[model samples]
Structures are given as C-alpha cells and as structure tokens.
Target: MDTARENRTWGALSDLPGHPMMWVLILTETVTFGLLFAIFAITGVVHSDVFSAGRAQLDPVLGGVNTLVLITSGWLAALAVEARVIGRRTIARLLLAGAAALGCVFTAIKVVEYATKVSVGIGLETDTFFTLYFLATGFHLLHVILGVIIIAAVAMYDSLDNLKTGTAFWHMVDLVWVVMYPLIYLVG
Candidate 1:
C-alpha cells in the first residue's frame, strides 16, 4: 500500500509539469541581482552627494512610466499563470500577449530615455553616477528584453504550463524596477 501511494504521488507530480531547471535559473538570477544591490549600496555610501545630484538629472516621468509598465506586465503575467491553473487557455494566452506587449513598450521607452541622456551628454563615461546608473538600468533593460522574448516564445508555442515560473520571474523584475525607479529618478 505504501509503494502504491508513493507511485501515485510521483505520477501526480509528473502530470503537473513545468521546467525543473527554471528554479535553479531563478535562484541564480536572484543572487546576481543581490550582488548588484550590494554594489549599488557600497557606491551610494562612498559617493552619496554625486549619486544624489546625478539622480536629479534623470527624468522622473520616464522612470515612473517605465515602472508602471513593468508592474502592469507583472500583473498580467500573474493573471496568465492563474488562467492556466484554471484551465482557461485562451485567457492565459491573451494575458501572456499583453505582458509581452507591455514589455516591448517598456523597452521602447527605455531606448528613448537613453537616447535623450546621450544627446544631453550624460552617458557611462560622463561621471561615476552616470556610470552606475547606466550599468544598473541597462542591465535591467536587458533582462526585460530577454523576459519579453521568452514570454513571446512560450506564447507562440501555446505552452501555459510554465506560466507560473514566468510570472515569478516577471514579479522579480517588477520589484527590482520599483526599488530602482525611485532611487534613480525621485530621490534627491
């Protein structure tokens, strides 16, 4: 009887499938972001005034909009995961598409912001603060682009099983943006 129960549990687990490797990928990404936060903290301590002044140059409107976009995408991703769990495949796909489109919008806005900064003579080589700002924001943008691509691919393939994992990653991205948006754009 115990053997039969164990078999049943294994079977159930197998039936509910998502990529096992996603957990490891997410953990590694979390560690990477943690290290980045640590570096930002250290830099802020050493160059508080410069960082503050540099932060002032950033356009708060753009940053806020980007933050909203990321947050909205995260919400959509969560909805997609929920829809998949409830067996609402069409809703799941629609939510995933919305998330992906929002991600694209986020990227476009970031590009515009970057272009404006460059035109105004603020870039990585401009100053320490700009360097840190570009490094942090640029890295985050890359992650956003990659996440969009991944979500688009999954949607194209009609695979909602991994929506939960994607949503988890999207939430992390949104959370990071929340912290970063205020730090880089609002606080003086």
Candidate 2:
C-alpha cells in the first residue's frame, strides 16, 4: 500500500480512542442500537397510551439504581485504563475487576427486575409496549454480559491497548443504558 494513500484511508482510526479496530465494533453497535431507539420512539409516539401504561408498570427507582451502577462501572474502567497507561499493572487489573463486578451487579438487578415482571404476568406477549420493552432491554442486557466478560478478560490479559478496548466497550454499554433507562422507564 502507498503510504500516503494508506494514511488517507485509515487516518480517522488514528484519532479514535482504544484500539482502532474496536471503534469499528463500537460504531456498528451504536448504529444498531440507535435504530432500535428510533424505532422505539416512533412506536411509542404511535401508541402513547400503551407506552405510558407500560412505563407506569416499571420501577424508575430500580432503573436509576442500575444507571448508577453502570456509571460507576464505567468510571472504574476509565480509571483502569489510566492506571494501565501509567504502568500500574496491578492497580489497573484490580480496577478492571471492580468494573466487571459492577457489571455483574447490574446484570443481577436486571434479572431480578425481569423476574418481578414475569411473576406479575408481564412479558413479551403482553402488549406492544411490553414486547419492545423486553426486546430492547434484553438485547442491551446481553451486551452488558458480554462487556463484563470482555473486561474480565482484559484484566487477566493485562495490556494497555486491550484494557482500553475492553473498557471502551463497557462504556458503550453504559451509555446505552443511560439513554435507554429514561426512554423506557420514565419517558412519555
């Protein structure tokens, strides 16, 4: 590849945070979720009553707690990246572990919330609101699970770039939840 042409083609990657290739994954996932969010907003507007009733069924307080958990986790992940960059490998690993633990906590809370909904006979088939509610949240929950795994793996592997990449994914998970929580649980 010609050097200048190659730089022209791949130059934007140089400015992205974490491993350059990881940004590709990030962009793809973000666009996917963005579409889901758009669809959700449009559908909610179309069926305002259904969405409103579904929102009433949710516990905003619990969603708030999960928001706090993920935010804290993302903070720890950022700290871990900084630590790794500074050659504090042990501290970095510990911070990554902590971040992953918070991710697990988020997962547990979400599972409990789902269980509560199920026990009350609320589920995917209940209505349009419940259906989108389950699908969107469920998909995001799966990403959270994967993020926890990635964070844990990066902690074990112990490389600065790997840590950055893993935590970048975790942060995306956090951002998605930050957006999704209000839209699904509190918004009209």
- Judging by lDDT against the true structure, name the best candidate: 2
**Model 2, runs deviating above 4 Å:** 1-9
lDDT for each of the candidates? 0.80, 0.92
TM-scores of the candidates in the order shown: 0.85, 0.94
Off by over 4 Å in 1: 1-18
Model 2 scores what on Cα lDDT? 0.92
Backbone clash pairs for candidate 1 read none
Q: How many backbone clashes does candidate 2 have?
A: 0
Q: After superposition, how far is residue 67 of candidate 2 from its true place, in Å?
A: 0.2
The best candidate by TM-score is 2
